[model samples]
Target: MDELIKYAKENRRLLHQVPEVGFTEYITTYLIYERLSQTNFNLYVGDDALDIDRQVGLPSDDVMANTYQRALDYGVPCSFLEKLHPYKTGVVATIDTNQKGPHVVLRFDIDALPIKESNEIEHVPFKEGFQSKHDGEMHACGHDAHAAIGISVATYIDEHIDELTGKYTIIFQNSEEGVRGAASYAKKGWLDDADYFLSGHVGTISEEVGTVGATATNFLASTKFNVELFGQSSHAGSNPQDGNNALLAASAIALSLNTIAPHREGATRLNVGILQAGQGRNIIPDYAKLECESRGETTQLNEYMFERAKEIIENGAKMYGCESKITVEGFAPSATCSKEMIDIVKSATVSNDAVKTIVDEVSMDASEDAAVFINIVQENNGKATYLIFPYHLKYGHHHPSFDVDEAVLEVAITTFINILNELK
Candidate 1:
């Protein structure tokens, strides 16, 4: 591997070893900030930059404390975390040359999944000794590499700001796995005043190394929610009749939610991933919690499903003489990529023949919070598109064996730089 590729790969491994989930990406954030902090670009992190009100799916205090201490053990400076103290995490750095041109924003997600990684001797990371150190958390997604690319772009532009016109903004977003984070920045006006906005996800649609998804299609809208059911606790054997079992309420709600009618006009989905409640076999549980989500091809369709979900959860709780509390954690809006933005990405990739194919469009039925940024930017008369950069993947995203060829990081860095310069 060339020096540049090797550098990027090393950075990815370092980040991969310290995987964090959602808004608690202190270790990942520090690495990027450390690499780009030396540049003249103005940097923003945490509370001031990310709207705390809009941030969702954050870890509990105990979990956040453990991760923060781990980040310190991993060599992240205490002074650094102190700067972002009041908030969890987010990143926005701007490089301005005082030239007259469109303001361009480049975004990248930097977070991991809550999955225990494989420890087999044959696994590349395990063999190479850069595997995740945190149990039950791993960089099953390519966000580690994406953060490296974001730093690379920041470094390159900071060095060449004199050669370029216009202002460039780089965002190292947090908690993208559950479609959270982007809205926090957007609602705070962090993405406003953009002439163009662009983002890329590596190896998602197809694993062909030379292909690039210039424009994504069929993006779905979704909502993530958390519910808690409350009931009176009592001894099972002696006071069974006096108990209102929250577990029963939560279980019934989960079943009813899955049976909600699908939208005839478009696709609709409901899933309840987590259900927790109970004290012991001999005691009637008074509390139960659930994590659930709904999705649809369009925003309206998703709204339709969400309404029914609330009803089911509420009525189901009432059936068991319990009360339900539901909170909407995150939301993603369906949207289509702009043709003009795709044209710019296509133009950038076509310059290199090694890029065998540049697809103008590809369907991404999976919901993405980035769509919120795209839609808001477009609404303000700015152009935007989500680029799907491909690579050869050993396993599907979010799997225990998930891994990608590191060689694609260089291509991503170069393509992003070229696109930033070409967005006129």
Candidate 2:
């Protein structure tokens, strides 16, 4: 465990140095494949043989083509990889034990956010010299850590493959931030035979160093929306009223959305992240657009709030005499942890004395596509649990300065290895 921790600390520092964003994580994926292939595990990449018959929502061929190219460029063993519809780059590797036992699936999401790296010297990326090449795109979230930890776990399991006694599948998923990746995976029945499934995030909310929290148990379900308002265009000075004023309608809709927030009780959240309208001040704006999200701890509450939001937008557009279009970009169902699975993870953490604290409460407001795995598992009568590991961070997620303590990476590696052993 001590050696593994040390290795993880060093590797995590290197991963932090080179940040990649979302599905285009080329260098990051290459590094992961390079490291994992060195172990005894059988590796496969590029979804070429996936049972599309089981796929839920089908993505375009162009998306899948780009995904395959990325995987191939990264050196993932793609010859045996399965292809599935709707998933651009979903890679699955199975560790078959040959012995009879329940199958388990573990998922790790490898994607970065769109934020520039902080220039601070103390910030890990700045010091490491692998900061993002693409401006405004960085691994501000701890996804680099997630990918590294996934590799570490796979390596550990591969090293002790002979002693393991069940089917273990490691899924390296892409595009979790868009929240559409996991749903596509689920629709394809990727986890149809699993007895237990697990996924997690690191450094989500503030907690003591090495702490592991059962976050998904209380996480909120969420929906992403893109709203477009259209109106007739006319000269602002000569006939402002005749233009219909789509910008005005968008502004009114944004303000009225605040009213929907307080209507839901108990930890409801809503935010309008992006709003764009108009080209010139002299011209009456003919079109306006908004990207918004809403969430709640339960599906029913989330849906209720979402409905109210729709009503607000509809009435606001009517009042402004503009046409409104609402499109759902993505959606993730709520997550609830299984008591039995939670006990397994908790016991592993306690046995190692890895962290200073282990939080039992739900602690994250941000949504996760990992929640999709929980939904699929439960629907298939299987159990799933998602956990969080706390790494001391100087800045919050999505911030350019966001950085994590490298030492915590060791704790996560140790915890994951122990859990895999115990579960086996």
Candidate 3:
């Protein structure tokens, strides 16, 4: 157990030093491959593990090329780099015991956020010399710890292969931060063969170190989209009327979007996170771009918000005689955990001394791409659940100062090992 904790910690710190955003985790993928390749698991990479056509919200081609080049400079083998080219960045591994039993699948997200890290000396990572090396990228959401726990569990399973009976599938998913990556695999029917499925997060609603949550409720359905408005550019002083003002159109649309009525049935949210327009003070802006998203407690409500948002954007652009293009970059459906799986999680760790408390459920009140995996498994008549293992957090998720208590890493690994044993 001590050695396992050490292994998880080492991997987590190493991952912390190199953070990458969704759909472009080149170095992240390379490091995971290097660690898991030594084990006996049957590994699948890139297009072999995903249906690329289903993927959305991918970075631009230039961004992908630069990230791949960075990975090469970081010493990733060219042969391995070839496997992840063309915007594929997920890894899946499976082990068959050749015994008749359940097929259990476990998923772990491996993408980082775009927020820059705090360089304060008091922060544990900064104090320990493992602060992020990449500018404007940090693991502010604990995915690094999730990936480490996953690798630790995989190695544990490999060492105890003779003691476990069921066929096991492990997924290291990418682009989960934006709710984009899971669909690539889920739509490909990756979870169709599972008898049992499990996935979760760290330092969510709970804040106690030894607490484990069995189920999550109220996962918000969400859609991320980008809008571009185009108009003719002209000199502001000479021909203001001839040039349609895309910037003015975008401003009106953003105001109307924020004023959309919330669904009476449940909570709804909308945000225009980014709005860029205009080239110079003397020239009329010919183009404007808006990065926005809508969310709701349920899918129907989310559609209400999205549809209304679209109407506002389109009509707003037309009101200014501008062309509008709205593209959906990512989406996640609302989901809930099965009671049977929740009970299993509770029973699996009931005897573990490390787990001090087992809560039946908690309000997630956020979006998670893991819903893609959980929903598919349940729809196929298999049991699935998204658990929460809480820890002391320095700041809220996606914040620059966000960090997790290292002890939670071991708790997560131990809990999964117990659950796997129970299923076996």
Candidate 1 residues 357-403, lDDT tens each? 78888888799888988998899988888888788777889888887
Q: Which window of ten consecutive residues has the lowest lDDT sum in model 2?
A: 49-58
Q: Per-residue lDDT for 1-424 in model 3, tens only?
A: 7788899999999999999999888888888877898899999888888888988888998988888888899998889889888778879989988877889999999999988999988888898899999899999999999999999999988988988887999999999987899988876666898998888899986478879988888899999999999988999998888999999999999999999987789999999999999999999898999999999999889999999999999999999989999999999999988888777888899888878898888789899988888888888898888889997766888888888789898789999999999899
List the candidates ranked by TM-score, beginning with the highest: 3, 1, 2
Runs in model 3 deviating more than 4 A are none
Ranking by lDDT, best first?
3, 1, 2
Going through the candidates in the order shown, the clash numbers are 0, 11, 0
Q: Which numbered prediction scores highest in lDDT against the true structure?
A: 3
Against the true structure, candidate 2 reaches a TM-score of 0.87
lDDT of each: 0.85, 0.72, 0.90
lDDT of 1 at 321: 98
* Candidate achieving higher lDDT, 2 or 3: 3
TM-score of each: 0.95, 0.87, 0.98
Model 2: residues with Cα > 4 Å off, grouped in runs: 1-3, 6-14, 40-44, 49-87, 261-265
How many backbone clashes are present in model 1?
Answer: 0
